[model samples]
Target: MEQPVHHFSELFEQLGLPSDAASIERFISRNSPLPPNMSLSEAPCWNEGQAELLREAVQEDADWAEVVDHLDASMHKQQ
Candidate 1:
């Protein structure tokens, strides 16, 4: 398996996200799925709520709500 190269702290530092790296990492790790479909695509106009949805959907283990949420949020943010 291809492992993530950096630690969560390093990743957060690079991105300058407001959320704590440990919390984010814990959330991600707990929610992780197999057959990895995880990918995040950003939009310039994306709102925080929308971005959150997109982030959730990209996780390999996301539920149906996450998928629909991402779609709805992305559309709302764009419009």
Candidate 2:
């Protein structure tokens, strides 16, 4: 079965950002290139904190893993 697609707003909060919709949109738009063609773990746009959080989420298959994985795949798709 396919997993449900949650809003990126939750992810913004998880990454220690404001969880507002407009802010989320702005962040994604501003973080262009998103380190195109690179792995999410190695994406240059992520700050040290953001990268570490993502790494933990993905590596541990945490509750946020699905969202983080979705983001990783989406980032590549947009490239």
Candidate 3:
């Protein structure tokens, strides 16, 4: 019983964000270089609901976790 894999666009959609490639890239560029001390869920960019969803995805290691981790890394990358 393998868990379903999720993509970045799907995760963005789940979070009620723009899921298109260009929009996703713009979002990452705008909000990226996340401070080394900060977690994705702790970023000021997220609302309460979005934060909770991010927290759960990581904590529970859900199908969304991989993409979430990818997002975390992407945000942390220096522009």
Off by over 4 Å in 3: none
Ranked candidates (TM-score, high to low) = 3, 2, 1
Candidate no. 1 TM-score: 0.27
Over 1-79, each residue of candidate 1 has an lDDT whose tens digit, in order, gives: 6434443344334334434756654534443332223334354434576456546645654443444344334333322
Task: Give the poorly placed runs of model 1, Cα more than 4 Å off.
Answer: 1-41, 65-79
For model 2 the TM-score comes to 0.71
Q: Give the C-alpha lDDT of model 1.
A: 0.43
Report each candidate's C-alpha RMSD, comma-separated, in the order given. Answer: 12.5, 3.5, 0.6
- Per-residue lDDT for 1-79 in model 2, tens only? 6655556778878788888977766666666446565768787777899999989988987778888887776666563
If both were scored by TM-score, which would come out higher, candidate 2 or candidate 3? 3
Best by TM-score: 3
- Give the Å shift of residue 9 in candidate 1: 36
Where does the lowest 10-residue lDDT sum fall in candidate 2?
28-37
lDDT of 3 by residue, 4-63 (tens): 989899999999999999999999999989999999999888999999999999999888
lDDT of each: 0.43, 0.75, 0.95
Name the lDDT of candidate 2. Answer: 0.75
Model 2 clash count equals 0
- Superior candidate under TM-score, 1 versus 3: 3
